[model samples]
Target: MSMRLQGRKAVVTGAASGIGAAVAARLAADGAQVFTADIQGEVDFVADLTGTDANTRLVAKANARMGGLDIVVPCAGISTFHPLEGHDDAYFQRVLDVNLIAVFRLVREAAAHLKAHGAGRIVTIGSTTSTYGDEGLCAYSASKHAVLGLTKSIAAELGPFGVTATCVQPGAIDTPMTAPAFDQMPEYRTFWEGKAPLRRLGKPEDIADVVAFLCSEDARFVSGHGLWVDGGAMVRH
Candidate 1:
């Protein structure tokens, strides 16, 4: 409906499902030509972002295919529940590698093209845990916290070059990754519901809309911020 991004080209990672898939669809609906990447899916690139080269190549391939890149939304992330006592190196490292390292690498790889374009937008996916530290989510919280810092640094460094960077810190959304937990532990869902004044959990579309806004000219002046799309849950907290 809104053709604000009609001529814009975007690369969205983690497009296989959940928030990532929603973001890809929203960007396309906003009229941007979207190139999607994921570890497994019918996407533009099936990349295991945990690998260094894959992160780099995903950007290059998107830029080449789209002729130019104006927006980049790195939405790939993994979360694991582990107590600090026995979090295990493998689990912690895997979470960091997927959530933080891959995001950093993608931004690094895409910086040149974005800078060259002189008006690039980078919208990263952070989580409410980006600021709040919750038990059993040490690695996820840590990585998301780092993401907020990373996005701020990116904005400061790239603002002069006409590039804007921001992070979206979403609350509990009913996505594939979280649905099972909500279903298995109804109390968990009820707790979140009670925490929000809106009395409802978020939908992937809630996050996708904010991301699309950040990538458009409507948000041209908005940079270096962590937007919490949590349906006022943080306020109640």
Candidate 2:
């Protein structure tokens, strides 16, 4: 509405639905030309982020489409429910590949372009589990925890170049990714709702709004921080 991001170019992953979709739409609405990537639905680029060359190709395509890059939002992720005793190496690896490793690769591929732009922004989507543990989300939690570390590391390396890196941690968002959890544990919905001070579930736009701020000029001095968009869920935790 403010056109705060006018002339800015952004690439948002997992943009077909949920928080990613909301974020992409918000950035575009804010006057940034957005190039989106996803394995499904209509998007500018379609590729699995876990693929070996997917990150490279995605960044190349975004740069080509937008002529340059100023913002990067790595919002792709996956989660599975399994106790620690049942946690297998394959499951752990798969979660990390999509949630953590892919993020690193995406940022690595886009780092130079972002640096060149100056005031470049990298906003990663982490989770409430990033700061704490979840009942059946060992691998997901670990990957999210590592996301904070990755963002902070990137901030350290990119801050001098006028590029900022930050993470937004959401709690119990209503999205396709959490649909399975809601189905398997129906009570989870009510439980999360009660845990939040807002006494309601979080919408994709709830997280997207914070992301918009972190990517805007208003947050120029913010970096290496994980902003919680959890509707006070973290406070209860």
| Tens digits of lDDT, candidate 2, 1-237 | 789999999999999999999999999999999999998889999888999999999999889877999999999999879899978999999999999999999999999999999899999999888899888899999999999999999999999999999999999899998888888888999999999999988999999889989999999999997888888988877
Q: How far in Å is the alpha carbon of 103 misplaced in model 1? A: 0.3
Model 1, span 41-65: residue lDDT tens:
8899997998969977888888889
Q: How close is each model in CA RMSD to the real structure?
A: 0.8, 0.8
lDDT of 2: 0.93
Alpha-carbon local distance difference test for all models: 0.92, 0.93
Badly placed stretches (over 4 Å) of model 1 are: none
Off by over 4 Å in 2: none
Q: Give model 2's clash tally.
A: 0
For model 1, give the 10-residue run with minimal summed lDDT.
74-83
